[model samples]
Target chain A: MIDYRGLQALAMVIEHGGFERAARHLFITQSAVSQRVKHLEALIGQPVLMRTTPPKATAMGQRLHSHWQQVRLLEAGLGIASTPNQLTVRLTVNADSLATWLPEALVLPDHPNVSFDLLVEDQAVGLRRMRQGEVMACLCASAEPVNGGRVAFLGYLRYRAVASPEFIANYGLKDLSRLPDAPCLVFNRDDPLQHEFLATVVGGTPQRIHYCPSSEGFVEATRVGLGYGMIPELQFRDLLASGELVDVVPGYALSTPLYWHYWQTESDVMLNLRTQVIKIAKQRLLAEA
Target chain B: MIDYRGLQALAMVIEHGGFERAARHLFITQSAVSQRVKHLEALIGQPVLMRTTPPKATAMGQRLHSHWQQVRLLEAGLGIASTPNQLTVRLTVNADSLATWLPEALVLPDHPNVSFDLLVEDQAVGLRRMRQGEVMACLCASAEPVNGGRVAFLGYLRYRAVASPEFIANYGLKDLSRLPDAPCLVFNRDDPLQHEFLATVVGGTPQRIHYCPSSEGFVEATRVGLGYGMIPELQFRDLLASGELVDVVPGYALSTPLYWHYWQTESDVMLNLRTQVIKIAKQRLLAEA
Candidate 1:
């Protein structure tokens, strides 16, 4: 049988990236931490850590870590005498979602004991974190549920290709074909929304593309006429309404369907967090499937 | 001979993610974009792109795109009658470098035609972008030169494990072993410097860890006593001196050596940019390396 203490020590090492730090986190002596890890490795008959600088978990180690994390969450949900006050809800999310409706969802009642540890990445890649057990939940663009997780439709995040009035005028961009030569803003190389919209109107990449990774920074870059880009309808509503930004192609936009995936747990904290996210998303995002 | 125009068209399709957008970027009709890509594929006797909702580059296509990007940079550097006014310098950098000395390097004299497209990632992973031709230059932890790029030693970024005065007093964390129960802050999962230091002092990870991804946010969280964290010497010098924060293990710290890697090019812009970076890094960062 696996010793729970040894398992916990191993998980902490992977999470903290060093045995010494893991010992500090476990409130134990360095030798104790080392012995626990050695015991676990001896039990398994193989090495768990790479033992490189800032150690990495082997595949077996990753699986073990994932298992321990899930078990901990399950125990915490059952109120099984764990450190309840120190429960952390680790999750991955996209920047746009965090900027728009996520803050409201985070403040929802009934999750007083849960603190957040958010990992922000592009929605396209966010699910990988959940799959790898790096996060317990994820807000992603994928509609497919994780192996044992429940997926909920969270509506579409509408994006309009927009630019400042001065940018359009300065570049004389009357149609989409001119976009290739004009300065354009992109979230990152992985972000495909701008290209998806451009596919409908023109059909190519912009020669002069400005990459602004921050959600607010992207809007600011667009506002300052640094480049034209696809801006979220919810976040850029004020700027669009006040004539600070203009749609490059009127009535044309891309609507990315988003989904929330969470582990199927009996925990009230998980349920409450999921419900709050759905509620906020429905209220703020486009209702289209 | 390979058709340069068709290659350009194919590269745009990969960048923009579809033929329609590629056409728009190329200032051509959708049919023309389709024809160009088809012609290239027919000549190569294989499909280059996976025609999905958001098109993706095939292995062959990725190679072609990388080659095209490099060629474009070389052409631009030679001042070979391209869009001279729209020169964009793409690079990847670590957050601490971005927070500390990078901004000053960006404003160096004699580089008026250049604009920036910066990708913020961990220094350990930043070099991969340069290797993949995703960026022309990178600030990375690796001292080895990329295939044809020059590597310059940029000195060490020293970090001290620090916390707010109240937190140290409240937790009575005289040594590292007590860190497990106390709150601790991490930059992210990939950041192992804190754990590395802890391994020397305690030998385990903290159980109650908070991840703050932003450079400023991490410092703010540490200052507010949400948790203790490893902070860069250059960034937290003022706070350390002001008594708002205290070193958890005084006189003990980690110094990570950094390096700048860039494509070996005779292009005046590339040369000027490299020189300016080295100059600024030497001035602000530790000069020992």
Candidate 2:
């Protein structure tokens, strides 16, 4: 049988990126930490770490690390009474979700004794983190679940192609034909909502483009007429109502379906967290089948 | 024969991520932008864009986009007089390079009329962005050049395992063995310099770890004695001189070699940029083969 302490040492090395740091984390002698890893490697009769500039786990090492993480989560869930401060929940999410509804979801009542480590990325890309075993759960764009994960539909996020009033007047963009020469704002290279809207109405790419990656910055860029862009309803409702921003192309919008995915776990903490996220999302986002 | 205007439309659509946006970028009517792309598609007898939420280029579309970008760069180099404000250069780099030496390189005498869009990631990951056609150049860890890029060696960045005096007194980490149990700070998951130092001294993974992703935050965390960490020598020299931090493992350090990789181009602008970057890197980083 493998020593749990040795396994823990291996996990920490990967986590901390070195033995000495791992030792510091464990409050043990660096030599002791090394001995444990060495012992574990000898027991397994294989090298677990590929000692490069920053050590990386071998394939087997990666498998072992993933195993240890799952076991740690399980043990933590069961031993909640024994260690109240040990809960560290890692997750991945999209920037829009984070900017809009996720913060409220997190502070919901009955939140377990846990702190969160969030990895923010585009929703389409966020699911990859779960597949790589980097996070326990993810708020992703797809409905399909990764292996051993439960997927729940979270509603669609509606977006309007909006521009400031000054921008509309300056560009004189009364019809789709005039859109080509006007500068447009995009969240990033990978953001497609603007493209989808354009394809539906104008059927080509914009002639001039400005890329703004931040959610708030994207809105601000649009507000200042840097370029018109698709703004999430939740983020732009006030500006739209105040007439600070107007739909450049009235009667047209885009809706993106979102999903919550979590590693299938019997842990009550995990379930409660998932339920709260879904509940908050439903209240905040557009409900769609 | 393929119309160059149609090809430009396709490229803009892919770059800007939508048709109307592409039209705006081109300073043409959206219908004209659409007609150009449709004309190109008819000539090619294949749809180039995937029409996904954030439109993706089909394999053929990717090839065309790459070709168009190359042509645009060449034209810009030749027609420098026609458009003085059109030069926008995109590149990816590691944070340490940004925090230390890169900004100095940009303002070098006779610097071209260019604006930079920088994508910050780890050196190992940044190179992939170049490979994916996301950026024109990258400063990466590997010396191996990408398929069509010129690679020049930038010297090594030396790092030292450092701790505040207060932390040393509290943990009593005089010897390598005591490192395992002491909390250590990590820049991010991919940072392994601390691990490399630990493996050399005590030969194991750390038992306790704290991850601080931001470069500035990592330094601040270490200064506050949250944990010792491997800090870039350039970043910590003043702190060490002032006795705010001490080398935890004296006489031992980690050195990461960096390289500047840029697309092979006849453009004087490209060549000048490369020369400036190499010169600055040599002065700032540790000289090595």
Candidate 3:
């Protein structure tokens, strides 16, 4: 097996570019980086770094780096004390979720030992990071168990079809079947919620669909009469209350189930965070419906 | 912006426990851990760790750990290389896909810089992980775009209700409505593909649903006359070809559309992966039939 330190050194070399740069980043001499890389090459029996030009990792080097990340993540998950005073946990999150639930969920406030490096992606991608030992835990939608991890249900995110009152006035939709003729705002072509609803109730497809990629914008488009789209209840509640938005279908709503997935490895901080997230999810989001 | 290193150090401390243990794991001295922790505290103007018997991070420490995770992912997406050579791309995928598409997708002939960590989960919960930045990408069923990313339609995973000739003879499922009354194998309660098919085609529900979580077991259960199930086309292809497993509905198959979601970042590696994935998806998975 290759030494862990060598892998770290090679990783630094690749990241920092060239021996001198890596040496500077590590606060060591350029010769030290050269020696480490040479030693790593001897151990791996392969040239991990291309010594020419900008100094890049060979194909084998990239693979080693990937493995190194896995080792790091595993180490993190094991909760095997690395340093009593290191105060950081990498967090993966979705952007809209960051804007909404995360602020609400992470309300405990102030820690010197812990600092958050938030990576915002879609939920599915985040789960991948969790399993790879990248982030310790994640909020995902998968109910299927991840290897070395436990899965929990976080409850459904209720959504409803809403449009600006102006839209309603112009489109004059009295029944579901007429929705196909009206312009509609969608998150993208893949969003099937609106399509499912239409297929279930209207027996047709929306005639015109506008892709509004942002969550806030998707809702705003509907509010401004661009078209009808399903909006999450949490973000749209006040709008509905204020009558800025009205239900296209008063009694009908879409509820999507959310779940949390985390490494099953015993980590006190992860355990605590998961507990707190679930508690808030149940109290603030799930219970509201 | 806060120095991300501080957060990483803090996360390590929380994971490890005491300064001595953390120092050992980090290959540093106990004094170094104490110094870093102290420095972090001074920077944040808050005490993240409690000096108890074992030492523990405060609630604030926990929050920062989670926050730090997200930032690391964003940095990756931005191609802001960390620890140079070791670039780990994490993702959550389903077992079925792992068995089928994943190995083939990762058929890179020794490019060592890229290491893939596969987190296996069901389609239902994969989305949440994507949101958390745990992974850079995911294959999920949701059409809704995540907060910071775009949703791309990969293709549909088509499944059909199949059973052994003997099983069908025993159950006598001549009509769709008779399905609910007969013994049926299901992936889980969330395995609503069959239910949706029944509701859409027969306007009824299954009577006795047997839960068999494993993909292999689902097929076996149906073949051995345990129950009928909606089996994926890929899994049941050989059986169907051999006339062992017969499709209950020949022309009718249930198709679930899957989408690939990733952070909209300008990383060369991510872009390359996405491009390759799309190419394979088009060739292997049928888009429209």
Candidate 4:
């Protein structure tokens, strides 16, 4: 059997980006870390790591690293931690979800031993992080799952084209045909929501555009008349009711279906998270088939 | 003199990723786009674009692209547009400022002709986007400017360690030394604020850590007892005042100095942005030398 310590060394080396830093992190000497990796290579009868500046993992190394993570999670799930009940689960999530209903689902019970490491990514390509083994799961727009993973539909996130009253008056937004002449807001170049909305409603692109990437800041920018663009229902519903934001194209809304993708695991923390996310997401997002 | 239309074609090819898309966008034939790029190469006396699958800009090509962008901006400033008045400026900005104060500065005067494209980036590495020629400016934490760029000191963004009352009570967070035993939140793996804050206070790292990348969501996560984390003064000052959040460590705060870095330009839009950002950031941020 391969020593678990060797796998730990391999994981640390990749995580820290170098043997020297891994050694410092592991509280071991640099040569010992190298020897363990060498021993791992010998046992596997193939090179697991590429010997480069700040060395990278080969396919074999990545597989072993993934195996090590799964094992660690299982151990933690079964209360077999050597470090006294400590686990860190890494994942990627979209900004719209993070700004809206995801936090309620995140507020788990008092087993604070299980920690989280989250990176913000666009929902369209979030699953790539999981495929790269950078994270164990991703909350994204696509319902497609990665290899050895499962997917759950999280319902649709509806977006409405909105602008402030002052903005509407100043830009003469009442004429639907001249909508393309007014300034508009987009999250970024990669975000196609504004284009998608325009394609559905006006069939012409806006001449003026402002990109504000923060989900909350997007609302604020629109409120202050930087431009008009699609705002998620979860974020803009209250604002619309309060008359802070008025739909630029009334009676029409764009809906994007969202999905939660996670590697199939027996870990209690992951299972609980999956359950919580599914339950809360169903309750919050627009219910759909 | 080199044909400006050929330079426009070259820029479109690099921007749209291929000749076909560039042709479609330019309302010209695919072969015509190719011929224009070929014409540019002949004028330069060497290859400007690498004939790769997605056609990358060589150093010469990148220089020409930057030159074209500058000339376009100059023309916009001088009102020489073929499509009347239209200008789009792209830049990268950090999230904290976006959530707190940047949007007001973004709401420019009635020229609505001056549009914006902003991408969210961590302050430490945001200048890389500008250096890559993807953006004309970057709002970042570093005072050091990029090559041929100008930087203005925007004062410091102060951060204080904070937690919910329930979290503090549940985790016994009063004792300063036992802080690392409690779960802590960070922006992401690349963020060093928690480590730096801990080093200053306890000199021990937290075994339980949560990383939430959104500046707004980070606060929400902390408020909902996901874990204690450092919150920016601009975001949390009201929460602190209203008793929604309490200081984990009183009488001490970490302050990150912010700077505005912009490519040296005579374009009115960029200059106005620089002026407005500096004026507001100085007012919002802590006065620091």
TM-score of each: 0.65, 0.57, 0.43, 0.88
DockQ of each candidate, alpha-carbon based: 0.15, 0.06, 0.01, 0.64
> Candidate 2's residue-wise lDDT over A1-289, tens digit each?
6677888888878766688877877889989988998888998899888877567889778777867766766776675566543345677777677656665565423533454555667766777767877677888788899888889899998889999888888778886788866766666677777878787888876655555555655666567656789988888888988998999989887898989888877466678778888898989888963
Which lDDT tens digits does candidate 1 get at residues A6-121? 88888878766688878877889878988998899999988888888777888878777767776776676676666553556677888777656665576433433455677788
Which candidate gets the maximum TM-score versus the true structure?
4
Top-scoring candidate (DockQ):
4
Candidate 2 chain B — worst ten consecutive residues by lDDT sum? B107-116
> Which window of 10 residues has the lowest lDDT sum in candidate 4 chain A?
A79-88
Ranking the candidates on lDDT from highest down gives 4, 1, 2, 3
**Evaluation by DockQ, superior candidate among 1 and 3:** 1
Candidate 3 CAPRI category: incorrect
Tens digits of lDDT, candidate 1, B1-289: 7667778888778666678877866779989987887888899888878888677878777667766666665676665566453455777888777656676576523543465677887765777767776677898788888888889898888899999898888777985568766767777878887778777888765656677676655676677666788988887888988999999999988888888898876467777878888887888889763
lDDT against the true structure, each candidate: 0.76, 0.74, 0.65, 0.81
lDDT winner between candidates 3 and 4:
4
Ranking by TM-score: 4, 1, 2, 3
TM-score of chain A of each: 0.88, 0.86, 0.74, 0.82
Quote the chain B TM-score of every prediction: 0.84, 0.83, 0.76, 0.83
Evaluate residue A25 in candidate 4 and report its C-alpha lDDT on the 0 to 100 scale: 74
B11: Cα error in model 2, Å: 9.6
Colliding residue pairs in candidate 4 = none
lDDT of model 1 at residue A107? 48
